[model samples]
Target: MPSVAEGVKLGIQECQHQFRGRRWNCTTIDDSLAIFGPVLDKGRKLRNWTKRRQAREQGSTPPAATRESAFVHAIASAGVAFAVTRSCAEGTSTICGCDSHHKGPPGEGWKWGGCSEDADFGVLVSREFADARENRPDARSAMNKHNNEAGRTTILDHMHLKCKCHGLSGSCEVKTCWWAQPDFRAIGDFLKDKYDSASEMVVEKHRESRGWVETLRAKYALFKPPTERDLVYYENSPNFCEPNPETGSFGTRDRTCNVTSHGIDGCDLLCCGRGHNTRTEKRKEKCHCIFHWCCYVSCQECIRIYDVHTCK
Candidate 1:
């Protein structure tokens, strides 16, 4: 069983990988940890802000949750699950090992006897660790818990069985199979899609027979209740184009951008109409490679100058 710290590190790596091209990329791991702390201390502060804003609004346009927050919640939860499951398969922990118990029955010219990755154990441990921190009986706590569980659920739903055939000269005389978890990158990609469609939730206090109960309702009505697999949030994100220490935004000033790109990473979008400064930069590279007989290759050094653009 890897320590909680290792799990957090893995989660941070995944967050950076998933949001590498986004405006609010996960560059400051420490700041992220502060926001998504064990008890979500920073998140709690945001929730308090939400309450104050609602009080002033008198129940109109409650709050728009930020996609960055949703992504963090999902990726962090998924990171823990991915790391623990991978560690189990690698025999890094003595407490648990590969999931051999779920192997399929023998026959059909194949045997399901390999050490399958134990994703269920990963999910169990993740829930115990991540969900335990959210002990608050409030809407924000509930929302975080739901997003964390959704991350684990995404991993389990994507797991698949892999098989290898063995025989004379690679014939299909016999086969070995095992359950495998999808690559962490794939999980990250899936969650990125979920983040894109994340929903804004309405957390309201309702009177119940027992007492006052906090309810999490989707802002928009859907054909069915919001899926547990969807990411949900309760507050809008700050404009990341300018520095805002309070909201943790460092701004995009001087950030390098693709002049030809029309996406978020492009100058037009990333600079937020601030325009950009262009300058020529010299870059060095190895080029003109040649393969030698025995088993060697050679290349000549090359230099090229290109125009680099940065947000003004």
Candidate 2:
């Protein structure tokens, strides 16, 4: 339970860090488990009024499964697996601990020793718990499950061998190696890359052994089929330039932007062509300090001015 809590916290922090400059910014409503409020709803109704009208005439499409939702599911699931694996390695779990049986053959003068974090066990726990709620017979459920697996798979893919030298004085006489998880930031980076290139999918309804079922397929046939490690979504994302509760876009209003950057965080792009305002401010800081014989030090105050840019 402690590991689960730690994992959720880790996931949320990494999510916020990864999306700090983006429009959505992974805003959480409150402290409860529903951190992502209505943002997680069936995505904002297709922004265009024409599309909405057409959809309404065409029997109206189901709420969309947005890429943002895909990312949230993946990161949250990965966080849980990572935390649970760390707990196992640290002997904090009663049912699971170091994966002694999953090591590879011994190498030159070194054997797989020490507690290898049981990432597999952690993934199993995540699947059993995180995936249980996604059992609905819908394409969105399938997408969510896929993203969840992708997140856990990232943990497995990033596992590396760590070694410790056992010698009299730091000599490499013998070594103990074990598998370890990569830094959570690295995992977040990988997932973010996946999110950027996430495949857009369309629902495909067909007959199955049980009955007619809904599945997802790439919207474009020429595009490569998405693998289990890839993130997939069935709807186009909102521009997120303005506050719209429907699409969960917090909007870039007043959000800090980079004046010089030409990327997404830059004022030009982030402000959605609305332009930005710049302001200069001064702040006092320690300029110089001298250490005394008694270890006491003093510094002069210096004021520095810098320009700040925010979306208008």
Candidate 3:
């Protein structure tokens, strides 16, 4: 449970880091435990049973299955697997530990001596627990499951052979190698790339012998199909130029933007062509630090002024 909590925290931090320049910024709602505020809210209307039924019968699209949601699901799942695998390697959990089942002999100069982080165990734990609640037959469930697996897949794909050298005078006579997960930042970067190239999917519904069946298919035939490691979403992302309660977009109001950038984070785009407000502020910082001979250091204070631009 502690590992799980740590994983959630890790995912949130990574989300914020990756999207800090974007409109959403992965802001968390203070009053709700849904984390990224109402961006991922789906069941809010479920409390009213009539609306839920109408939504199901009419096949109305829910605002929860956007590309941002896909990224969130993938990152969260990856975080859980990463944290659990790390904990298992550290022997923090009694039920799981290092992977001792690595078969075959070692390489010419290295042997598998150290504990290998059990990524399979972590993936299994994440799959069984994280995917258990998404057992519904709807397309949303399928989308969530696919993104979750993609996250876990990122962890597995990034596992590398980590080794330690052994010998006198730091000379490498032999090395002990073990499988280890990559840094979480690397995983986040990979997933962010995936997010950029995420596939747009369409929900295909059909009448089956059992009942109504729904599956996701690529929206465009011109593009390549999304693989298991790729992220997919059934709906388009919100433009995020203005406050939208339905899509949970807080808008770019007061958001800082890069004046030189022409991308989404640029002032022109982020401010939605309404222009921006600029302000000059003074900031004091430590400057001209010099190390003393006695291993101490001292610095002089400096005042700096710069123009800050924010969305109107």
Cα lDDT listed for each candidate: 0.73, 0.80, 0.81
Local accuracy of candidate 2 as per-residue lDDT tens digits, 67-109:
8788888998899999999999898889898987766678998
Q: Which candidate achieves the best TM-score against the true structure?
A: 3
Error of 3 at 225 (Å): 1.6
Winner of 1 and 2 under lDDT:
2
User: How close is every model to the real structure, measured as TM-score?
Assistant: 0.85, 0.85, 0.88
Q: Number of backbone collisions per candidate, in order?
A: 3, 1, 0
lDDT of 3 by residue, 1-312 (tens): 789778878987898889878776765433223433343765443344344333321111125788888888899899989999999999899999999878578889988878899999999988886788787778988999999999999999999898999999999999999899999999999999999999999999998988898999999999999999999998877777775445555567788888989998899987889999999999999999999999999999999998999988
List, residue by residue over 184-292, the lDDT tens digit for candidate 1: 8888889889988888888899777777777688887863566999988877776577754346455677777889999988999888889999999899999999999
Model 3 weakest lDDT span, ten residues long: 53-62
What is the lDDT ranking, best to worst?
A: 3, 2, 1
Q: Which sections of candidate 1 miss by over 4 Å?
A: 1-3, 29-35, 38-65, 207-213
Relative to the true structure, candidate 3 reaches a TM of 0.88
Give the higher-TM-score candidate: 2 or 3.
3
